[model samples]
Target: MKALIVYASVHHQNTEKVAKVMAEELGADLVPIGQAQPSTLTAYDLIGFGSGVYGKKFHKTLIQFVEALPAVTGKRAFIFSTSGGGEIQTHAAPKKLLMNRGFSIVGDFSCKGWTTWGPLKLFGGTNKGRPNEEDLEEARVFARGLKEKYI
Candidate 1:
């Protein structure tokens, strides 16, 4: 199946690491949010939206990309994110946005990434060296599932 991953990873490139593994497993293209075109998304059978968690949500640019997209039916989408905590709530808003746009929700993934945002920087960092090998292996597994099930 044709696939693409459009993501934002400004702080530590954590989410980018995970996105790369998933993309390699699925043979999908990787496009940074700044370079993605909403008009061209329909070409893929699967599309992934991901970013590092910021203030409990996705990066503003990634959210805006989904918002700018015209509604469609039967488009397949998956959500992923990386954060110091890897909380489930981080995917909530983006999932809702994709559903509202009529994309069929497939699955989601999240993992801890090095984070030193805010006061954490004062204490070194959290989850340092994360999105580590194990997390990436899990992402590959997740992508394999999506391909086995949907592709």
Candidate 2:
């Protein structure tokens, strides 16, 4: 099945790491949202959107991508997020946006990523080196489930 994994990341590249693993697992194409144009989303059976949580919401690029997506009705999709904190809303916002655009959300994934901002960096104790081995394994399992359930 043709699939696209689009993502936005700033600071650490944790979100992109997860996207790459998912793309490799599904044999899907990887599109960096920053470099993707509005019309570049039509050639896929499944589209996965992911982003790093910024101030409790997804990156602006991701929001814009969802806003500009053409009619995706009946298309399969999923959402994934990487954040320093484990708030589910970070994933929910994008999922809701895609759902409103008529895409079917098959699954979602989230994991803590290294944080080099604020007190976390000074404290030297955050989810660094992550979207780590466990997270990638989880992502692989999630992709396998998507393939099983939808493809």
Candidate 3:
């Protein structure tokens, strides 16, 4: 099955690192959200949306892109994010947006990322060296599961 991963990773490239591993495992096309066009998403059997969490949400550009997409039925999607807190709730908003568009929710993944945004930078950042080896391995595994289940 063809797959694509559209992601935004502005800080420390933490989310990008995870996206790369998942893309490799899934053999999916990888594009930054800026480069992805909503019109082209229909070509893929499965799509992954991801970004680094900012203020407890996925990056604004990613959210806006999803909002702009035309609603579709039977399309499949998964969400992923990297946050200093790595809370599961960060997926809720985007998950809802995709569902409203009639995309079937497949799976979701999250992992801690090194974050220096705002006050955390004063303390030399938090979750230093995160989205590290173990987290990436988990992401690889997740992608493999999606490929195996959906393909």
lDDT for each of the candidates?
A: 0.93, 0.84, 0.93
lDDT of 1 by residue, 48-118 (tens): 99999988889999999999999997789999999989876889898999999899989999999999898
Per-residue lDDT of candidate 2, residues 1-151 (tens digit): 6888889988689899889998888888898987887566777788888899988888998898789877665689899988988556777777787888889888888888888878768777588688789889998999888877766
- Give lDDT tens digits, candidate 3, residues 1-151: 7899999999999999999999999999999998999987989879999999988889999999999999997789999999999877989999999999999999999999998888879988999999999999999999999999996
Which residue runs of candidate 3 sit more than 4 Å off their true CA positions?
none
lDDT against true structure, model 3: 0.93
Once fitted onto the true fold, the runs of candidate 1 whose alpha carbons sit more than 4 angstroms away are none
Superposition TM-score, candidate 1 onto the true structure = 0.97
By TM-score: ranked, best first = 1, 3, 2
> What CA root-mean-square deviation does each model show from the true structure?
0.9, 1.4, 0.9
For residue 80, give model 3's deviation from the true position in Å: 0.3
Cand. 1 Cα-lDDT: 0.93
Q: How many clashes does each candidate structure show, in the order listed?
A: 0, 0, 0
When summed lDDT is taken over every stretch of 10 residues in candidate 3, the lowest stretch is 115-124
TM-score per candidate, chains pooled: 0.97, 0.93, 0.96
